[model samples]
Target chain A: MATTLTREQQRQNTPDRPKPGGRPGAVGGHRNWLAGVAGWLWLVVVVVPIYWIVITSFKEQSSYYITNPFAPPAEPTLGNYGMVIEAGFIGYFVNSLIVTLGAVIPAVLVAFMASYAIVRSRTGWFLRSVNSLFLMGLAIPLQATIIPVYLIIIRLHLYDSLLGMILPSIAFAIPLSVLVLSNFIRDVPKELFESMRMDGATEWATLWRLAFPLTRPAVVTVAIYNALTIWNGFLLPLILTQSPEKRTLPLALWAFQGQYSVNVPAILASVVLTTLPILVLYAIGRRQLLSGLTAGFGK
Target chain B: MSPTATPTTARGSRNGGLAWLAVPALVFFVAFGVVPLVGVLALSFTTWDGIGDINVTGLTSWQAVLSDPGLPHALWVTFLVMALSWAVQTPASLLLGVFLANSQRYRAVLAVVYFVPLLLSSAAIAITYKALLDPNFGLGAGLGIDLLVQDWLGVPELAFGVVIFVVSWQFIPFHSLIYQAGVRQIPKSMYEAAELDGAGRVRQFFSITLPQLKYTVITSSTLMVVGSLTFFDLIFVLTEGGPGDTTRVLALDMYKRGFQANLMGPASVIAVILVLVGLVLALILRRLGGRDATHSQMEGA
Candidate 1:
């Protein structure tokens, strides 16, 4: 905590304003009513749909059309959620969890090690090139490679399998993971590594003990970010996995929406159910998640 | 600070064992990422309906994709979405960022709420919009707001407009959060100096805020532009490239051709184009911002 505070103070001292010290400060906006209006107006735009979806998810389909869309259900029923679960959303939910965890765990572990190597052995030209390759991976729209990925999956006899999705997802998650992890890993003090080394610890041991513990927050942030992404991923499952039994939540949500085109509540319930885990996660980790996000991107 | 610095540490850290640690990530990336990157280019020249044996016929796929009017239309739609969404999101997010940067208790609450859309999957958000914008049984008909009731994803111009609006609705919060961080990062002393110079709040925003956020703008815009190219799931779930293919962006075009129609070669052509456009745009944005590798890695958004 003391070190972090000092580091933060150090960060504050070295302002990254493009114009040496020319940062806009005094934004005391008591009369900035236009922006205030815009902010609240955007709030309505964001909240109204969510509000409608929640209320609609609880309403019976028989009364859904006759009632107001924005109004709370006069006679709420749990039938929509019940129908959704009965329609196998729980299975889809489980598939999504497997894919998310399946991809994220290995991606973070492998990425953490790569980050440690890049930061530790910065002098190695080959390692530097590898880091460069990952950085270049960032600029590529890795999604565009889905066609060839599909081809590879088919050839590997892994089509229609959750593992197929997991492989490519891990590959795509790496570049950013390495960048963020390396950024955090670089912040670990050199003295700490030297002390561990002097104690006769191997690089691997020092890595797990010193680097991993110190960068645990970054590791979590990377995991959550990748998990959210993989959980919400649709295209991979859409093309790679063909069987109903293999559908992840996003693909299942799309398929479920198509199946229940007439029953809006049931579809809405599936959306809610699929997102509930993430929303619950957000509620619990809102502070850590948001700050990690802002810091990960903003830094 | 020690004058000797890190000669020992730097040399000591250059162990060969440390270099091998990057192997697993490198191997995975090469097999999946680097290989596919090259594979897309190679596949573009071949004619194979995704299930059949591989056969290469150079330049045929390119010729077909280039000659087709659909390609240009898709490109134009893509260009429109990228430009329009950037224009809309950049200003609103910048202003909203400045607004949210204030450390009021209410603002904290607002940030939490604003982030809700970011949590929801694009498929869910698109599905929600689809139901809400259903001309007959939607929010409009339910509320009797005739103005709100329209075939939002059916009509051509309106469909295009809906695409941009939905894109903005889902993404502006995220970009706004980035800008908010950018705003907070501004040194307070600069604002004090500007105040001492008698600059009003609006004037200070124009001068200090605008100029200092140059890099942040590039970072956000790069993500916005490059990210817009791959907006397949949102557009697919919402409109499936729409009533007349009016919303068929490149990503959707690639998917439809490759998976739906079994035309992998043509789709690979589109994929190659996407990679080029992404690279070119990223480089242009990077060049525009001069140079800062770390700041631009904010492209993860």
Candidate 2:
């Protein structure tokens, strides 16, 4: 314990030390032709379906039936996309956007604050218990608590509303968010925090100015990860909300697929649309998201 | 997360004042998380139709759930999915993780392409697979391939198999990502030392790499197994426990009983079971990983 901190402290003090790069790549790499074959085969297995979804989504309804499923559309058309959007897809997208942004921002904020407390006041009994409680929370799969959550939301008169989904989403996201954020905050050199204290900064001020800035990448990573989870969430929306007006994208996609069972292109179009936003976000934050994908469970 | 985060001995205020910073999150979790946890247990003991007045019922829901043969089947199916998916994913992910841990540039591109599945929702994935497997207009018919045109989600065994396959399709990439990180963390010198000892590639892997990945295997397996417990969205959309309840896992069982059938009490009981099973499995997997990994992960998490 002491060794890691001192070593990290030394790394911080020594400007010449290039920050530890991503763990050194595995050695004896090409010798494993077997993993390579599996990798490429797995890649094909993955990409083929995704490829089918995109290309078939662009095909005309009849062409979708006639063309090779693996081939690109013969006469590409936006008709499926048009059909999807006009059928209340925009409203579902907006509801999803609202639910995701509403839940993720506050979830990450409060989680960040809690993580700051956990890391900054490590030995404090209350903070330690709080930290451990969040850890224990991870084991209590949020799905199991759905029935109670449904009842509670009804009692609170939040049921069937976006707020209903947002509240539980934030709660469910807390444990992992705190896990990832605290790990990142713990890495901010204590010497910097000590200096921040010497500068007469309140813990709150230091949290925002020092700890938060230093750990911004972790914050972004946590936010993006939570956003993806909440955005793609199905159960909470399915169980919590009732009205079609309130359905999030994932729930709407299911319902749309059910309604358009025969309209494969339209259904695939909805699938494509449901995934596009996160794919864009993934493109933007791929490195941080990949590095922190396990939510610090790996660490 | 380090378990070893010592208290910052910043003089003058090594105090508990920062505790309030944690209070907001605690309050939310307690109300929504901890309270609901207690609430689920309490609800299990009550009779509520999910709408009408709640009446206290002693052991009635338990008695009903215990007597129902469907409960055992549901539990068995849930266990099957967890075990099957774990067995399928672990080795595949471990190998792929080791494969991607390489510095090869094309492998990085492969990693990017492989991750596309992880971004899509379970509902979307299920929908895509549903359409792709449609007998009349799906890829099977389009490509004129009779073998690809099977009623994948129709028959009991095939539906069960499709559920497992779809779960793997959506999740294996994410697990592979974790393994990649795990493999990368392995010290290169371990392999170098094994090479000096006249170890071949396969020998080095068995002697060094596999052993070093013990913690990673446990972590990934724990996540995979535990996460599979609540896999409601995918299975619900794909098969809806179809072809006569072959794919009806516990999460769906709870949902159907509570929300669909208006039997909230029995559903709450199922929810409690799910929670218990999850905690037990997590603990068992941690134990399998040994004390150091357990102390580091459970205590440190």
- Write candidate 2's Cα lDDT for B58-109 as tens digits: 8999999989999999999999999999888888888898787765556767
Indicate which candidate wins on DockQ: 2
True contacts kept of each: 0.55, 0.61
DockQ of each: 0.38, 0.39
Q: Tell me chain A's TM-score in each of the predictions.
A: 0.89, 0.89
Worst 10 residues of 1 chain B by lDDT: B1-10
Best by lDDT: 1
lDDT of 1 by residue, A153-177 (tens): 9999999998999999999999999
- Pairs clashing within candidate 1: A25-B191
lDDT of 2 by residue, A1-299 (tens): 44653453343232332325644444442246678788988988998898888988999898777677888887899999999999898999999999999999999999999999888765788888888888899877789999888989999999899999999999999998898888788888999998877776677778889999998877887887888889889999998988999999999999999899999999999999878888887788787776555555554
Prediction 1 global C-alpha lDDT: 0.85
